[model samples]
Target: MTTVLYFGLFAMSFDFISGYTGYLSFGHAAFYGTGAYTVILVANGLVPLFPTSTPFMISLLVGGVFAVVLAVVIGLVSFRLSGVYFAMITLGFAQVLYIFVRGWDYVAANPRDGPSVGGTHPAGFEIGIPGVDQLNLAIGVLAGEEATVLGHTLGSTAVSYYMVGLVALGCYFAMQRILHSPFGRVMLAIRENEERAVAIGYNTYLYKLGAFAISGFFGAIAGGLFAGFRRSATPESSFYFLTTGDALLASIIGGFGTLAGPLYGHLFDETVREFLSKSGQGGGLLPYLRAGLGDQALATPIFGDMTLGVLIDTLLNGHASLYVGIVFVLFVLYVPDGLLGTVRTRVGGTLADAARDRFRDDHSTPERTEGDDE
Candidate 1:
């Protein structure tokens, strides 16, 4: 769960720029992987060179900073392009990174033994059992002989659930604020019509670069967590361009401009994966689903590629992405607003009705009631 939450943070950050700003960056996985590797590099030899005894908190912060810096570098290079060119360019960069990682025999062959990443933590800092300092706070404290004061330390699942939930919440609110800001207004203008926005004294380049940089920056943070979670940094495992596609799925499947929508999409996809994996198709949802019933009779059809066949039979059971993509296509074609958007529309209608009570006077009430009845 902690792991999922970390990925969610990166996804939310990606959501802010791509989901809200309308740039479909397909290279975010590079940032995510870079961030994870950065954490490993720092936590190991790098920390000792600069400072003494770098703790987990420091590791997390530095990982984020490093990813952001890398994002800036990537943004400056790629945001100048647009449309398919932009997507392709970002992909090219990610591929370049992937190739480098794959070819670097030392990094490639490494066993990925690094500092472990995450675990449990309390929500909001309320010094449980007053007078307890940092030391006593280790493993939480006792409130007059009861360990329940600060609440039980969350399990891995609970921790991840809460962590991801908070980050998602923060991302939603923060993006909402940004969308309502003057800069966000410029983003809207650019999205509506970039040429027109540029003509109206808005520097589209700067706006685009800013959005791209921030989006990549957050994605990198997610990548860093990915490496950290596994305590390994294999070239193939550390970063992959396909991962960015995952983020893109979240953005497109959910309405592009709405904050909560992409998150809903991402959550749905991840949750589905989790469900499928847990079911019996040899550890993958698709394969498990494709398999027959009665006592685990699953079929994993395949093409000629042996590696893919093996991996598919093992991890995917079949083409998980294909199945998921089909679902997305169907959703986009028919239910365009996505899972959350659908819910929001329903909720919006309910809330709108709830808002009418205060506006209704005796005369208006009768008409409103009639309208409601009708």
Candidate 2:
């Protein structure tokens, strides 16, 4: 599912920097929105001027590049702050971005439209380019264009699903390899203890900034996939703390600092939310008991959802921060190591012990040199 893939990528990207480096960037969504906006901005010309230039692909790359640059900038600004200060500054910056995007009337009025095939000669006319006269994408302005490919109608929502799925899987494996690399080990050291890492001659700032930039770069790629595939990138989706929150929720719920935890987390959150929303379609006791009874059940809308989003969107759905708060509380209260961390501690410790014992036994062999050694 795109839902699973999207949030899986979300978790990995967030954890790649935040969980690994211990920076805990709250404004991480800025990079993601930046990617979406970047791609959309880059490909606007290609669709109209050079229709066969593959704007979609260019948009993805541009989005990723923009994410990397923004991450660098974000790293520079917030690298000085740590813990609460880092979180505060990150949150502040995210709000600033959200407000700016929301206030911009041009993008708001028009929003960003997707890359469309524009034509010169109208009425089902096929035109060829000057130099490359052979290749012509003569698409008719006929009915049901969206459902067909080259005059063949095919039910192809599955294509989008598979594409996103592969992208997410690629990112996941790549991240896993990176996490196991020497650089990733250094990042873990920095996360475990920045002072000790610095004392040991590690450039904490560089590593942190590098991790942040790389994480954000991938986050933007994911965002671009989401935006381009969806064909509609809105301000709400692009610039928001909650976007980051959703990723955080996925990370936390599915077990942060693990290989595929966020993927599971997305499934959990999306399934529960979707189920609750679709099932809660009636004016319940709270609404009917009140004076106003027009089949409207909630006081306000939350992230375009009814019920719970309306009830506590302010304190709770500020993204998934509210829900994650409860989860964090539970995690701290009971499982301090997180789900995967807990499992690794139990299993990895035993494996290490066994390996150590084997090594000791291998070296401790009563050497046949008992008579030769002095």
Candidate 3:
């Protein structure tokens, strides 16, 4: 799903800074919200830089730049404080922005409701290269304007999915490459032991700042994509501290330190939530379970005013948050290294040992045959 990919990118950004530098940022959503608002403002011609609708690509870059600017300011101030102190400061800044947005109607379309790009375009949210309508992506399946593709009437959403997905994939690979470089090695070194790094002449603070900035840049880009996908930017979705919290949750579940882990974790998280949300619908998990359980078993009350079926149904309806929290707690207690990390530690070692044994068997000099020994 495009939405999942967009959020995956955001989670990866969170992991980039926090996982590597051990700096937990509680205001990462500030950058995300900023980028979304920047893209929407620029695209809607509200910004003076573009008298007309800005091209989608340019808008995304501008959004990222704005986020990076915010990151620098936040990092400079927050990095002065380490650990929890730094996190709280970042959170304080984000809350300030959230409160300002919620109360300011002159800038926002509505203080409580937030600003939207409007539903004038039938195709959910779309972005086009300047003067080239054909080169555009609309980010919904059948919700957008119909376009002919290979004799099929496919909406802009299908095309947009591919476009956005490709961008996300490219961003992931780029971050991976960065993490494998010499700079990445320093980042790891800093994470492993900041004091030792400093003692060895490495400037840990600068590296942390750099990591934070890079994280902000990627986060903003993801936000821009989300704006384009949803065709609107909402303060509640953008500036809410929960957004950052969700990213943190994903990174922890996915595996910290590994660049790809958060991406996979987010995808898994989104998929589970989607299923849970859909379970109550006609074609969802609830319907199938209800059918299998039959009317009698379902209606049998397990407790006063609550049937066994009702409890299960209630959980299937809107209990994703509860489930996620439970999973997080269990992970923290049992699998501290996280899903990917645990797998790497367990399965990876087994495969590695097997390979080593095979290598030894192949490379070891064979005992001389009886005749050759003679």
lDDT of each: 0.58, 0.65, 0.78
How would the candidate models be sorted by TM-score, starting from the highest?
Answer: 3, 1, 2
Return the TM-score for each candidate structure.
0.69, 0.68, 0.84
Task: Encode model 1's per-residue lDDT on 253-324: one tens digit a residue.
Answer: 665666656666677777656655535433555544455342223333345544433544576543455667
TM-score of model 3 relative to the true fold?
0.84
Among all candidates shown, the one with the greatest TM-score = 3
Question: Residue by residue across 1-374, what tens digits does model 3's lDDT show?
Answer: 77778888998898998998888899999988887877777755666765334566777888888888899999999999988998999999999988876666644644455543422232235555645678765564445555677898765666777778887888898888888898898989988898999998998888888889989999998998888777677778999999999898888888887666777788777766665664544255666777799999999998899997988777676777677778789878898877777777875643456679879989999788879956
For model 3, the superposed segments whose C-alpha errors exceed 4 Å read 110-135, 140-155, 278-284, 301-308, 314-317, 347-374
- List runs of model 2 lying over 4 Å from the truth: 46-52, 105-154, 280-332, 335-339, 342-346, 349-374
In candidate 3, position 63 carries an lDDT of 86
Pairs clashing within candidate 1: 1-160, 31-220, 32-220, 32-223, 35-224, 36-224, 281-288, 291-298, 291-299, 292-297
Off by over 4 Å in 1: 1-4, 47-52, 104-153, 163-168, 278-322, 345-374
lDDT of 2 by residue, 1-374 (tens): 65567657867798887777777888888877876665554444422343334444455666677778877877798888899899779878878987886666544324354222122222111212333434222222231112345887543354455556766788788888888899999999988888999998999899888888888878887777666555546667867898888788777766666757667767766654543342322432332333353335445444555554356334323234344456557866787655655665776743446689779988996757666766
* Model 2, residue 7: C-alpha shift (Å): 2.5
lDDT of 2 at 363: 92
